[model samples]
Target: MGGGCCGTLVAVHLLRQHHPAHIDMIDERIPGRGLAYSTAWDDHLLNVPAVRMSVFGSEPMHFLEWLRTHGRPDASPDCFAPRKVFGSYLQDVLNDAVRAAAGTCRFRHHYSRAARLTYDGRVARIALVDGERIQADKVVLATGNPAPFSLEPAVPGCFHSPWEPGALTGFDPDADMLLVGAGLTAVDAFLALQAQGHRGVVHCVSRRGKLPHVHTLYRTLPDSFDAAGTGGARGLLRAIRLRARAAEREGYDWRAVVDSLRPVTNDIWCGLERCEQRRILRHLKTWWDIHRHRMAPEIGARVGAAVASGRLVVHAGRLMGVEPDGSRLRVGITLRSQAPLSLSVERMINCTGSDENYRRSANPLLRSLLESGRIRVGAIGRGLETDRHGALMESDGTASGWLFTLGPPRVGGLFETTAVPEIRKQAEALASYLFSIVREPEDVPVDYFLAAGI
Candidate 1:
């Protein structure tokens, strides 16, 4: 019950295929922009190239074609356009799908938040924050990423999420600002501030202080890479290193080797045991993220320039504490293999990115479902438990035919579910599965409908 990219794309797929039913899309924010693309900053470009960002798997150049039609004749497959443009494109596609549905199918947009969900062996009931309830034969939970983790004893002049409107507003352009993470979100925050003419030092601290790798134009890997043969995390690392060395010998960049892993990442991840997954998360997740989730070339250049010019300082440390310091905040940090240090900053922003733990989520709907035992947390304690087809699993270990999910909610089951490439594929597959299971209202048990008290 979301209207972001995942929800919109799934809806488009279902509508285009003529799903004969009424679809209710719900979200408190705009349907297409979601949290990631709602920004007004033009400096924020997509991480992936345009050619690879299509919503349809069969048409890889769909996004490029859309760009060309929208006054961007010079746009090529490799160009990384502003994220807002992509958001606009998504809106256009959703509009077209809605128009195509005509009288055969109905699409409704609900500008509200989902508060709770309940199932009674047949139909599902969804309650909204406005005290309205809706019943459906099937439910798809596309609720996207959760908010950033909050620190205890909320400190003034500190922000937990940078994506909120006006979160970075009203700050002095010349005042030093501290960022709590050095990943893509941190990079986005740095660029957003720079775009606003912020000239003060941007101090970024993380466990490794490692930024995402820069994108490069390179050829794809050879067909003999054998990514599936890697036994576990250690074996995968060794194999990638070997491939990187061989690619260097052939005068090719190592990026091609990493990109080659994209098609088989889920396979490799599924082959590993739960302990192996935890090991990767503890030791190699950061390194893998930096390489796998590289930034756009242009954004990377700006970040490099900022660091080289002493305007951005990145440190490898852990945040010990943050206390009030009269007019500013005193941030305590402990660097690896070094003594603790303290810095007073005018403001601190938590660019630490999404919190994957569902148990700790503040969303009422998710908490309700978890507490009611309607859905069980994943084995890794990161997201909801789901089968291969995105069907949610109940606490008693049975797949829920009435409930499904995609995107970040399936990260624990599918290691690479967040990106566009993987998500679009999931959308298409889900739409196909739902279409196969379409049934008449009479086919569903009347008792199931009455169980929701609708």
Candidate 2:
């Protein structure tokens, strides 16, 4: 029910497939732009290059071609363009598809948040926050990542998520601040603050004070590891380490070894038992993320400079306590094998990234669905449970006939579903399946579900 990149990509595929039916997208923000792409800061560059970030999987060079024609004439395939440009590209792609399907298909965008959803026999009814109701034969929950975890005490100076509009505003230029993570999100926050002329020292604290690795040109290695054949997480980790060492001995970068696993990561993840998966998430998820999701070279350089200059402090610690001071906040932290340390900061920003645990999500739509047993939490409590084809699974272990999802919501089933490469393939396959299911345009009627009682 989102109008973000996932939803937009799905709509584009449906239109391109010539689905002669009505399609509706619901979101309060600008269509084709979600939390990740809504940023206007140029320093928030895409971690992936233009060539690998296409909305259409079949058209690998689509984004690169678009960049070249749209004000980036000198853009190369490996160029990591500003994220805002990609947002505009998505908008243009949606617009082009809409124009192409002008007479054959009907499309509408609802500028509202989805509050509830109900399915009765054949039709699915979606209730909007503005009291609007719409019915369709199928509904796809393309809602991207959930918000960051809400910290306790609800202090005034604490920003729970840096993606919120004006989240970095209202802070003094010379006031020291603290970031509650040391991942890619934290790096983005630091860059945004720097762009805003925030000259105060920024303290970044996390369980492991390690930032994402930098991207570099490396040789593409052939597949040498059998991820599916690997016994478990430990076996997979050991194999990767061995392969990385071998590659290093051969004068190849370990990054290439990691990159080579892209095709088999999901296979390995799915092959593991739930307990094994839990073990990986508990101990190795952070390490995998730092390597899998890297920073742009330019971004890495800036962050390195900041760290070298001591303006950015990295603490491998956990936040012990936070109490409000008169004009600021007093934060307590405990580093590994170190004594307790305290700091007073003017602001604290939560950059821990998206909270994938849907069980604790406070979104009205998800709450409604969970309460009604329309959808269940995924294995290991990571994301929503979905079948291989992206169909949602109900509380009773039955796959939903009409409800489906893609992107971040399918994380538990497909560990690597969030990236553009994976999501584009999903959108395409889901669109084809949807097309096959509802072969005739008249299969879906215009009547709303009276049982919904909206």
Candidate 3:
């Protein structure tokens, strides 16, 4: 389990509901935060704004309250506060929830990493990196986003992923750095280098060379676009296409159409057949992305400034290959216009977005589950396929009752679930399910097995 947003929220909800089970949150929750909501770096800020990022629908001002209590004098209403502050808000909620509990369930935190997890009869055995294991009736896979996709092997002079601190370790500030894939993560890498006073040239490469667009705070947000009301995938596309055209005529811009479609994205996704989903993914995914997931206003400015300063270059191309060139690396890339370009750089970081291409995560756990026919991947390849109730279905068309998934792994199952709003909802639902099965002896029976001993 994590102490991040998803993990903390689940613990909070379970305590509030008085769920029966011992809860051990294994994360450096008291400090250091996490890779996402790091306060150590003041430059790091939350991607989401305060108004919309709430712990619960009923308590919309919970986070704002935390800010008032802890950071009131200095924090601005419109400020994209440092992400670490958000973590503090979450930790505060957890503390208060436990404080107010009449008969709080067994709750504690183990500040250690989960080395391995395996099923043990009706209970799951969790082994920690510090050589400890606990038996629990149910397990939640809430390990937030995993490490970023690697652009190259972990060889010297090649920075393969942004999140790994080792990549940035002892990196020469003046050496040229190449960033693979121009996306949000690439922006983060650029910002990290900027914050670190790295004055090297940052080259970002992608097929369209498209970076995330800025978020425009429109005065009047559009009403929800009900694609399901139209009935099917064709109808959904027709509705969006028509709305986009009308928005263009009204000078509303494409943003409105995309924003309006947010609430109904999952509906449209689930409504479509497998073939239709592929059609949309292949032909329309990119067009949809550049308009949808927008950047923070301040962050957007920094990215643009990097370009203007000639420190960052966005190249529209395909990476042909990269070879080690004594003390540096030569990257062969094919551009759309130019014949071809081969550049030598001290390092290359792959900010290529999520390895939703599941197989690519190269995760032993996921691969084991897949090969055992205990889990099935969805159309987008981002996560395990499950029903509305969140059953981990197998490739042989069977649902495994013992295993469940959480976080972005269910992106295909819920389109908006990657973000906080949707993730909180999922965590609540998952907690409810786990609580039911844990206390109700033999009810909701699962064919669970144990791995004997670790």
User: lDDT winner among the candidates?
Assistant: 2
Superposed model 3: Cα runs more than 4 Å off: 27-34, 73-78, 152-154, 228-241, 248-253, 394-396, 441-454
Residue range 291-398, candidate 1, lDDT tens digits? 988899999999999999999999999999988999788999999768797888888899989998888899888888878877888899888899888888888988
Number of backbone-clashing residue pairs for each candidate, in the order shown: 0, 0, 3
List model 2 lDDT by residue over 106-206, tens digit each. Answer: 78898999988998887888888999988878899988998888877568788888876666876899999999999999999999999999999999999
Order by TM-score, highest first? 2, 1, 3
172-225 in candidate 3: lDDT tens per residue? 889888888887778877887878788989998988889988876663345877
* Alpha carbon RMSD to native, model 3: 3.8
In model 1, residue pairs whose N, Cα or C atoms come closer than 3 Å (at least 3 residues apart or on different chains), thus clashing, are none
**Comparing 2 and 3 on TM-score, the stronger one:** 2
Error of 3 at 167 (Å): 2.2
Candidate 1 Cα lDDT to native: 0.86
- Whose TM-score is greatest here? 2
Each model's lDDT: 0.86, 0.88, 0.72
